[model samples]
Target: MTKKRKSRGRSKGGKGRSDYVECSNCGSRVPRDKAKKVTQRVSLVEPTLARELSQKGAYIPVSYVTKYYCISCAVHYGVVKVRAREDRRTSYNS
Candidate 1:
């Protein structure tokens, strides 16, 4: 049985304001709490990521598709299977 990985919760670090909030992609400055209100928390999983749980199993979260915004997480309540390359190789061999 595989253990489920939990989301990384935000740190309400002491009152010192953030130095700057930058876009995860473009590095452009995002308004305060704007990044906080992102569209979705895109999947950070990859076969090579050491910490990633098995991508080939039935337990994978469906949000791996649409954005997984922290606050609006329920938007993608349905989960779809995205085949990982690791599992795809079996089809070719079969």
Candidate 2:
């Protein structure tokens, strides 16, 4: 068998098994290591109100939202880009 990616499309290295997570968009079950996780910080207050409060020395609260996407959904939503044959074999962090 031939390998398409060096990591086999999963971040679990030397681990036997990994947990599964549901995709936020399609609601499909995908492995935690294989799924793409995105975290965004959302402001509780509106931009205008937050600005006003900041001037008054009021602290604005923000919430963190995390989303997981499968490979198909990740590609569809432009979260991850398709790599070339050579690029697939190399790690971007290296």
- After TM-score superposition, the amount by which residue 74's alpha carbon in candidate 2 deviates from its true location, in angstroms, is 0.8
Q: Report the alpha-carbon TM-score of model 1 versus the true structure.
A: 0.22
Q: Where does candidate 2 stray beyond 4 Å?
A: 92-94
What are the lDDT scores of the predictions, listed in order? 0.37, 0.93
Q: Best TM-score goes to which candidate? A: 2
Against the true structure, whose lDDT is highest?
A: 2
lDDT, candidate 1, equals: 0.37
Candidate 1, residue 56: lDDT: 43
- My TM-score estimates for the predictions, one after another, are 0.22, 0.88
